[model samples]
Target: MTHRRKTLLRAIAPVAALTLALTACGSDDGDDSGDKKNDKSSSESSDTSGSDDGDDATDEPTEEAPANTGDLPLGQAASEEKEIKRGDGTLKAKITADKVDTGENADLTAAGFSADKVKGKYPVYAYFTYEITEQTGEISPGTDLNSTTAVLDAEGKPGSRFIAIGGQPLKGGCPEKDRELEWKKGTKATLCTTFLMDEGKEPTKLAYGMVNPLLWAVK
Candidate 1:
């Protein structure tokens, strides 16, 4: 009876050991799989963070420079010769104090503007002569003169009280005329434009052009 019991015990011991070994091996494999999953998750998180940092580094702002005003004349006036180069053409422009007129003129009434409605100190008129010296296209002196012309006050600011009357008669300088006259190369014309000045606010200069490097009518 004792010998039979021992043989049975030995067989049961081997079977139990085999079962324990298999259980241990399964536990190790499960731990290794969990560790591999954790490593993959950590690597993915690191990659995502690095990509975000690279995006943030590229999203910054930059500053821009100011415009150049070196070629503009600040305070020039009439009777002085100014050589202004327009697109594809050059003009010899001149303004003269001798051609400037103010007060209640008969020509202003004849043109349709009432002297009674004149704002500012009084209505003033000036004559501009544009001689197209060199050109590759037709130039409209009247249109360019009206659009780009501005009178500067004594404070070096544009006069807000003035009304621009383009293409007025050269002799009377009143009754605004639409001078759409196109001058080809080597042509010249004397055009008149009127302005109304504020009381005691004398114009110090004239500025031309809607862009930088403006042609200034200096006093």
Candidate 2:
């Protein structure tokens, strides 16, 4: 009876030792899986934080306003004559005389212009004498004294129609010529135009072109 009991106890002890070893192995695997999960969560959190910072760094900046550099004021007469150069620096112009005159003057009549052609009641006229020079190229004449050349009031508004006197000869004044006069390189000519203004309106400047630099104020 004692021998039988000893054999059974030995067999039961081996089985119990095997069960304990299996349980220990399972516990270690569970701990490893938990550690892997924690590491993955930490990495994902860091990636999300980095992505947010990158978005902020790539944000667009605000725009600024343009600076106001030196520019001539409107209606202020220049102390001396001002020269305007063309974009290609080939043509140059200077305002020789700019003044207000009556449309009934002898120069207008002698040039074959009647008072009926003048639009305003008082028949005030704004005359501009421009001396243009072709520095490099041949510029077509009579093109510079067209409708674009206008007399502007103090508010920068253009005056009425240009006085046309079909290239007629005048007494003691420049002839009113309608034909195109071509200027070769290094040559110059005097061009003139007369604009009709409203009654009691005074011309403050001459707008030779669309730009402000081409505007010449009266003295």
Candidate 3:
């Protein structure tokens, strides 16, 4: 009876030990799988973060106004079409192209101011208009607009008959002592000028056009 009891006990002990080993092995396998899943999640998170960073770059706009209008040596030297409005003042002028002769000697004359430069030169005047204030002066006999009233030259120089006008080559301010009337709108005057061009710096002749303003000024 005693030997049979010992044999039963030994068999049960061995079986229990085997069961414990198997349970431990299963738990280890589950832990390894969990680690692999964690690695994949980490990799996915890194990829998403990089994508978000890339989107942040290149997320912002570029045009500038013409610098110093009518306050420079050559009208800011703009090759593009531009208008010199009164500073901080709202004065509109309807310019007329009474003459536009573009050849080897292209001459464009209109408005009250006349831009006299060698034809066919770089930085030449393509378009121009002047607001001759309602004043009194002699422009060119037929031209009622005052020549020295307050003229903006092709080089962006603002000239005034006023004595206190500043001495800036590009911009001229009205001197208090000699300021004449501004070239205003509604001046009933005839628009007359000739376009001339020539070889080099000398004006050769009037080659192409001489016209008159259909309707130059609007109040």
Candidate 4:
């Protein structure tokens, strides 16, 4: 070989080796970049799966507790003052059933009621006290005791009610009079109600109010 050609071959050989080394480094960098991209995709997939699991856990239904709606005694009803609303006025009041009487046929006869009026029936008289503790917005304390009160038989139904007019006094000593005077704070009233049930059917309960009534067991 010529001396000039030998020097040129040596220089070209080093240049080719440097070029090969640079190409190998570039290929390695590309591989590392692809691996990093695959890792990121896998991490994103795992995060999405975790988020879906969290949503599923949150979507599960939960149970709620039941409310109490049991019947309460007369004394308990008296102890609990209820807010009564009428005609844009509000009144806080309580009722106490003090006495109950099951009348006889002789007693009915003495009260000027015919035997046919109460024949094959049980007469019931319930005495109660109505009290007003707080009043607001011009509310009246007067309540229709004969209409509001009921004597329930064994079938959980109201019996025939006897409403006396003109403030007549019953033989059982329950007056038919209901007072409607000045209703102020700390005012109270004694009221009575009467009911008649068929013979062999006894009164089991006494209830007051038309809705969400207060209950009392017959003694």
lDDT of each: 0.32, 0.32, 0.18, 0.42
Instruction: Write candidate 1's Cα lDDT for 21-82 as tens digits.
Output: 00000011001122221121100111111111110001111111112233233323433344
Q: How many pairs of residues collide in each model?
A: 10, 2, 19, 0
TM-score, candidate 2, is 0.41
Tens digits of lDDT, candidate 4, 40-90:
210011111111111000011111111113445554545666555543355
Each model's Cα RMSD:
40.2, 42.9, 41.1, 41.7
In model 4, which regions exceed 4 Å deviation?
1-69, 78-80, 85-90, 137-146, 165-168, 176-181
Model with the higher TM-score, candidate 1 or 3: 1
- C-alpha TM-scores of all predictions: 0.41, 0.41, 0.19, 0.55
Q: Over the stretch 46-137, how does candidate 2's per-residue lDDT look in tens digits?
A: 11111111100111111111112222344333333333332223344444434444443444344444434332322233344544443443
Which runs in model 3 stand beyond 4 Å of their true positions?
1-84, 101-181, 188-219
Best by lDDT: 4
- lDDT of candidate model 3 versus the reference: 0.18
Regions of candidate 2 where Cα sits further than 4 Å from its true position = 1-100, 104-119, 122-142, 163-174, 178-180
Model 1 poorest ten-residue lDDT run: 21-30
